[model samples]
Target: MRRAEYHCAAHHPRDWVEDTGAEVAFSGRSNVGKSSAVNAITGRKGLARTSKTPGRTQQIIFFNLDETRRLVDLPGYGYAKVPVQLQQHWEKTVRRYLEERVSLRALILPVDCRREPTVLDWQLLKWCAASQLPVHVLLTKSDKLGHGKSLQALRQTRESLATMPLVSVQLFSATRNVGVTEARERIVDLLSGQGNGRKPA
Candidate 1:
């Protein structure tokens, strides 16, 4: 089997409707290294912009792959500097895309390995639950923690999210390329309708 080729297609707000057959949504806190992870998975540099400022991605960015699959980089939520009204708008927009977009296959939720789950993370998870969307938590920045600590963090996260059924979790570090291949393979499987060990419910 060969790897898929990914390229940035366009960036637009949630209201902008485009035809993307199958897509995977990347969701996480601000500056949690979501863009870097996408670039690492695709083996392409500068495909997704890295920003120091939280909530820099105020719109949904779509990367089309081989004219078949799409990788969506959603706007980061819970940034303090962004106005409350704008934040609410972003939340609504993102929620709409996740709940309403017919082509979305799954959501990859990234969380800082060193930090515990936050309120916003739980809120997003709840939204996914309500919409019956499959979510896999990617523990980002695992390189920042020791092996034992990383394992502990994963366990804690699993316990925290125990109520959500069929939630998959993995450790990832874009800089060291840890778990990049696994992530890519899983994404491909999901897009190809071979993932989740069963049909999507």
Candidate 2:
């Protein structure tokens, strides 16, 4: 695939691009390395800007690999110091996009490997489950943990989601280039309507 290029950013659904063609979305808590993972998987440094400050990404940013394929970066949730009203707006916007976007193929959820999935993470998972949307969880920042702890975390996350067949989890470290290939392949699978093990609703 060609390198993804910046397409657009939308703060409201009315600003969203035409909802046609396939796109996968990446979402996670603030400071979870979501941008880093996007850059690693696309092999394009700085494609998605990384920021030390939480709530830096305040809009829905789009990166297109081609006319028909794209990747979306959603505003980070949880732990952002943004105002409550703004957070509520983002929550509604993201939920609407996830539930209604026709071209969205799947969701890529990144969480910090050093910590268990947070309450907001579970809420997103539940939303995906309700829609039967395919979700792949990336245990980001895996390099911070020892090999054993990383594996244990992965196993525990898998076990926690054992009842949710549409959700898959894996350890990833964008800084170390670990699991980048697998994540890319999974994105490809999802875009082509293959991965996820079930048809989207």
Candidate 3:
């Protein structure tokens, strides 16, 4: 995780660097803490810009994970306040990147634990499933719930993902430093060519 460093931000296909190495993408609805999780995973305080402002991440940012692998922070979706044209552009950019990137190894999806996955979340999951890509879902904001409630949320998420064999679910709280180590290990293993699609135990 120490080796993770900012690489570049790409707003368009022409601006994107050549996709030639293993990479994983962090994706979620606006304000779901993708930036916070990225910062927590890499132990970089200001790496991804934790912001209360929704839609702060307006482009796909790349970060190098060690020497040969990379991490991607994709723009969030499903927020309504943004202009229609801008939202359409985001949708197109994200879909194109996911469908065409050759070196993408996995997806890290974050969702609020207290609420059921929104329609947009389900849409994203379906896209990943269609692409035959593996995923790890972080039930963010788990610390805001009681232990029993958090466990229930995790269980619900896991059950919902039972049909998506290549996707795994886990309770995570960037605020409480929970599940960071496990998340790092899973990602590092994926980068190491372990494409077996192991489920969380």
Instruction: Report, for every candidate in turn, its global Cα lDDT versus the true structure.
Output: 0.79, 0.90, 0.87
Candidate 2 runs further than 4 Å off: 197-201
RMSD of 1: 2.8
* TM-score to true structure, per model: 0.88, 0.96, 0.95
* Clashes within 3 Å, all models in order: 0, 0, 0
Residue range with the least summed lDDT across 10 consecutive positions in model 1:
1-10
For model 3, the run of ten residues with the poorest summed lDDT: 192-201
Clashes by residue pair, model 3:
none
Whole-structure CA lDDT of model 3:
0.87
Predicted structure 3, TM vs. truth: 0.95
User: lDDT tens digits, residues 3-66, model 1?
Assistant: 3343443333424536457778899899998888888888876778888888887778877776
Give the C-alpha miss distance for residue 59 in model 2, angstroms.
Answer: 0.1
So what's the TM-score on candidate 2?
0.96
Instruction: For residues 1-201, write the lDDT of model 2, one tens digit per residue.
Output: 446898999999999988888899999899899898999999998899899998888999999999888899999999657999999999999989988898998899999989988999999899889888899999998999999999999999999999998998899999999899999999899998896633433
Winner by TM-score: 2
- Ranked by lDDT, the better of candidates 2 and 3 is 2
The predicted structure with the larger TM-score, 2 or 3, is 2
Judged by TM-score relative to the true structure, which candidate is superior, 1 or 2?
2
